[model samples]
Target chain A: MPAPAPIDPRGPRFNQAVLSVALLTGFLVDWRPVVPLFALVLLAGAALGPKYGPFLVFYAKVIRPRLAPPAEMEDPRPPRFAAAVGVVFLTAGALAFAAGHAGLGWALALMVAALAGLSAATGICVGCEIYLVLARRRPVAG
Target chain B: MFMARGVIVIVILFAIALAGRLYRAWRARLQDEKPIHPLVPDSLRAGADRTWVVFTSPYCATCGPVEASLRASDPGARVVKVDATREPHLAESFSIRSAPTVLLADVEGNVTARLVGAQAVDDYVRRPPSGVAG
Candidate 1:
């Protein structure tokens, strides 16, 4: 029989990029109260990171026993996903900061990074599911 | 190690960093807003009109060319994109296992074309054949 898919341990700390980009975006768009927000992002990514594995331990905890796992239980996502997240971080952060919003862009980027890390740690890809639900409704969500 | 200790060299490096940052600040521009994610989904075909969906991820570099040409050629065509990594459900509905997958269909709700990987839109537009749904 084919072996069950292994939950790959590591992926790019795309969240770090998200935090940085978020800060950059805020800077480019609006530069008020920048240091604190940007600093928060940097700290979060550095602290709770894309370590050798997730902080939550999906395989041992979420998956093995069976706890309402979603359809994508078989494959946790490719390592390439980290790169894509980075692109989103870089672009969105740059745009938001450049748009003259508050340093909210920095906060937003860090938030995404934290959520992303949380999801990965928990074996739940928030972005993937967000796409799924949105796609279900909108034509372009796909 | 002694070669790196020169103060003038460090000064020049910092100046270049500052210059690069300023350049980007001045030149930053946005592309025409285009969805760059899950390109296709089963539900995207739900509408009465025939549809063509492209499943793409930012990692797949070539999807941009295809999306641009398609929009320029026929603005009315339904070309949806869902970031695959971010939207695994959309990808799942269409059985998307890879990046840059393309799906096409007619008004009847049957898929006509399902192409995986980056495809040159010119080749599709020029020859413009019925896809998997027809």
Candidate 2:
């Protein structure tokens, strides 16, 4: 298989920073509107590549140009996995809110926000880390 | 009241993020100094002066630079790249919780030093394992 293109390590973190804010707002205020927006952003990122994701589009078009080139590029898989994980959480959160389970919705949103905030602040991709750990634990196929 | 709740939630999230960062930093530092715990599998043992046993996954994007860095640092050394996804046992046995983890071992397969991220490649090369004459 052909190798995947490497990406600026900062791009995903930048996307996460934007996501953290949206998620925080959703959790703290009215989650009804924000849930769908969050879910759309995350699902787009997960289904498409990070470059195509809304937040990353902003990062690429605006934020990236203002900053110096990345020190190194990385494979897109981990962050894509992270985006997928975000989709799962946000989807569930949205559903909970729609179902009138406010507490559950808030908890899920909080989890996503916390994970995103960690990545944004420390560049520590917790969802990606979780994906790695799970991939490492799955039984190998013959 | 709603604003206060929001602020409290944000504060809690910040605290959690901070704690996670600190824990990761501590683990990375601790692993760098510690030898490979005895639990690592025998297959990882290498018969080389300084073998670079790198643990990577197909999903980890950072592994490319890490592999490149290891090769550049010690062109002559044998760099063994293990796909943690295929060899999950290796990760479990080594207690490898993250990707791009590199273990430097001596000719006898005794792990000399551990590195837990792509960013630590320079440190590993700069401080080559002890007892090997430069």
Candidate 3:
């Protein structure tokens, strides 16, 4: 298989910082619109890659130009994997809230928020780490 | 009451996230002190006096610097770069859950020390714990 594309390490983390705030606000307000919007953000990131992701678009077009080039470029797979994880949580939360399971929905949303906030604040991508572990354990195809 | 609950929840979420980060950092540091004798893949076995096995992934930005530092620090030791994505089994054998994880091992493939994340070359060159015979 071909090697994955390289990305500025800051791009995903910046997107996560913005996402954490949106998620936190969505949970605190119990705002239904916030859920779908946040889910859309994660969906774009996971399916389309960071260049096409909304928050990352902002980072690439606006923030990245102002800063010096990154000392190193990273693989895009891990952050994309992280975005996939976010989509799972966000979709589940949104559905739960729509179904009137407010408590469960909020719980799931809070988990996403916490994980995003952790990555934003500390640059520790737990979802990415989990992906690595699972990928290693998966059986290789012939 | 509702406002207070929201505030409490937010605070709790942040606190939990921070705690998890701290715990992982602490654990990574602790893992460095002991020799876990991680398994080495055939491709990585260099048959050298000391081998620097670097576990890296495509998404690891800091990995390049770590590899460079290790190579610069010990010209004598063999440095092997393993792509965690392509060689997941290698990562699993070493119990590597994160990128840029460096394992210092002996000729017999016994891990002497493990370093996670970015560090100076000196950090990697430091002598391993005496308890485990290399």
Candidate 4:
């Protein structure tokens, strides 16, 4: 496969910030629907591309215009993979909530929120790091 | 009820963050020069004057590249690959929770350096085993 296109490093941080806040709000409000809705958003970004992601597109069109360009761009694949991870956790959390397991649902959602918050605050994306490790498995020339 | 749930959420968030921090610290500890106590059996231990025993699991994506890189860096060096998943006891004995953990040992089976994770592959390649021609 061809290399993934690069994106503004700030865009992912923006997405992470929104995701963290949304997830925490969902948990605090005991709004079960919020988890799955955000999961769908993440799924769209993972399955399609940054252009299809509401948060990323919003960043590109609105937030990005207000700020100067980043000094370096980053590969989009890692963040896309991170979106897929978020989808998995949120989907599972929604399922748990649907099954009346509030504790499990909250645990899953909170885990994702914590990770997203860390990425947003410290720029240390655990899911992206996992993606990079997996990406390195691709056959390299001897 | 909502207030209680809010507290639960905050607690869970803190728990996750604490777990992450603890994991990083543990990994760092494993990277220190901790010898392989109660030396491994002859079948699994280093067979040469200097060897790099790479503990890997089947699920580890970077294991193959890490092994390949080590071999490429030193054609004559002894590189042993042990599947941690298959050998759970061995992995447990060495306190190996992660794959691609490279342990450098001398002829006596005494570990000199402990490198873990994909990042360690570059580190080992940069500074190979001492007193042995790379």
Candidate 5:
């Protein structure tokens, strides 16, 4: 199998910033649709690659051109895997909201928001780090 | 009232995040060189001119890259990675609380330099060790 293409390191951070803001807004306004919608976007990104990610596409088109190219690029797989994990949290949170568990829904949603904010601000993607560690644990194919 | 609850969640999470950041910072702060523990196995340093003992954890993003860099920087040095999560006693012997905590030791097994993060590891690697000419 071919290796996945590398990506600009900033692309994931840009997506994280947008995701954090959207999640906070959704929580504050008690919007039921936002979490699931964002979850779908993340799912698409994880399954179909960066071209399918709305914010990543936006970054590539609008933001990336304005800035100087990054000094280093990074493996796209880890961040994409992180997006897949985010989908699980978001889906659970949305389910909680639908089932009238407001507190639980907010708790899960807020955790994702906080993590996304941390990644956006500091480039510390805990979910991505988890992905790398798990990858290391996997047995190599002969 | 619902908006207030949302705000409360945000505030609580914010406080927790701040506490975590401060704790990691405290843990990663610089310290004076210390002696290697006798209990640490002799085999870890047996064959290297300079042995780099790295304490790592499963979830540390920087650990892999730091190990790679350390290996590439010196042909003579050997890196010994200890999984801190699995070997808590070894981690405790050195007071390690952060991942990628690196100890640079000489042939005599005395730790000459201790580094806590990737940036410090890079800086240390860039310079020749204390006795070697740059």
Candidate 6:
């Protein structure tokens, strides 16, 4: 049989995000050792976006099909869209850090931070068009 | 013995769901395998702890509240999110095909529970101890 098509890597972004959210939650709950670890991963995902982005794409499109045979018309737009959203988070994080809004920055970072976790719990991505409707648009007027 | 067992069918079904979650918890338990340059790790376990392994995707909407409920209750079980996008292998390893998947594990590499669909936190509330292997 012909090889099955690739699963969308963007799909797992939600899961990965959810995982991180949970880990951060633990940090929040415990507030001692894990915050740094969470920060490291958060920072890394940002710095290494290009590297990991493609990997996530491949995983979502090609790899996911093996175990979870995707729907015929699975949304192919999430990874592309999530890249845009990642920028939003990184920008917010940067601004917060720059303006000395550590608390605000953390909160903002946490908002975008929920991406992968949201993905993991479901196939619906925060970056997809549907999310564009559910989530409020940014007020920056960009 | 048979009569006693037959009397608790609801409890038994609940037990089955909990049993299936064991592997999910294990897969979630799998730490994000190491990455040399701190980019996204190839394995789903990258940069994650054992407590959280959620098999969800970018499109799934139902998982949100379920996750919130779980975190609200335990406050420490940290839910590791795995985008079927990033680590499909990890999801396969745990035998999860559905979105909004959840795996409840401990820090010691043991998966005690898993839920495949959107489940309420009450689904996992105040139940008997889970039955995952060491």
What is the per-residue lDDT of model 2 for residues B1-134, given as tens digits with 9 covering 90 to 100? 58886786769676867787797888778657544465233465544566788998776667877888888878877788888788766667777766789887777776666778776766666776586522
lDDT of 6 at A74: 37
For A1-142, candidate 3 gives per-residue lDDT tens digits of 6556678879999988888888777666667667668889989988977767999999999999999988556777777888899889989988998898988887787788788878877777899788656665662221
Which model is ahead, 1 or 2, in terms of DockQ? Answer: 2
lDDT of 2 by residue, A1-142 (tens): 5557878878889888788888777666665578668779888877977766888888888889999987657777778889888888888988888899988887787788888888878777887777656655773221
Give me the displacement of residue A112 in model 4, in angstroms: 5.0
Cα distance off (Å), candidate 2, residue A125: 3.1
- Over B88-123, each residue of candidate 1 has an lDDT whose tens digit, in order, gives 676776677655667665666566666665443556
> Which one wins by lDDT: 3 or 4?
4
Per-candidate TM-scores read 0.32, 0.74, 0.70, 0.57, 0.66, 0.33
Residue-by-residue lDDT tens digits, candidate 1, A1-142? 3222433333232333334344334434444344444443333333443232332233345444664433222223333244344445545655676786535555555455444444433434555555434444553311
Off by over 4 Å in 3: A139-142, B24-28, B31-53, B57-134
| lDDT, each prediction | 0.48, 0.75, 0.76, 0.77, 0.77, 0.49
Any idea what lDDT model 5 has?
0.77
Q: State the lDDT of candidate 3 residue by residue for B71-94, as single tens digits.
A: 876778889898887876767777
- Give me the overall lDDT of model 1: 0.48
Docking class of 5: incorrect
Error of 4 at A41 (Å): 3.0
Q: Give the lDDT of residue B106 in candidate 5.
A: 73
lDDT by residue for model 5 (A43-69), tens: 888889899999999999999999997
Candidates arranged by DockQ, highest first: 2, 3, 5, 4, 6, 1
> Where is model 2 more than 4 Å wrong at Cα?
A1-3, A139-142, B17-21, B28-32, B36-50, B62-76, B85-98, B103-106, B110-116, B119-134
Best by TM-score: 2
TM-score of chain B of 1: 0.54
Strongest candidate by DockQ:
2
* Candidate 6 share of real interface contacts: 0.04
For B1-134, candidate 4 gives per-residue lDDT tens digits of 88897887677567667766876777677667455555645675537766778987544556777788888987776888987656668777777766778776677777776777767677668886577455
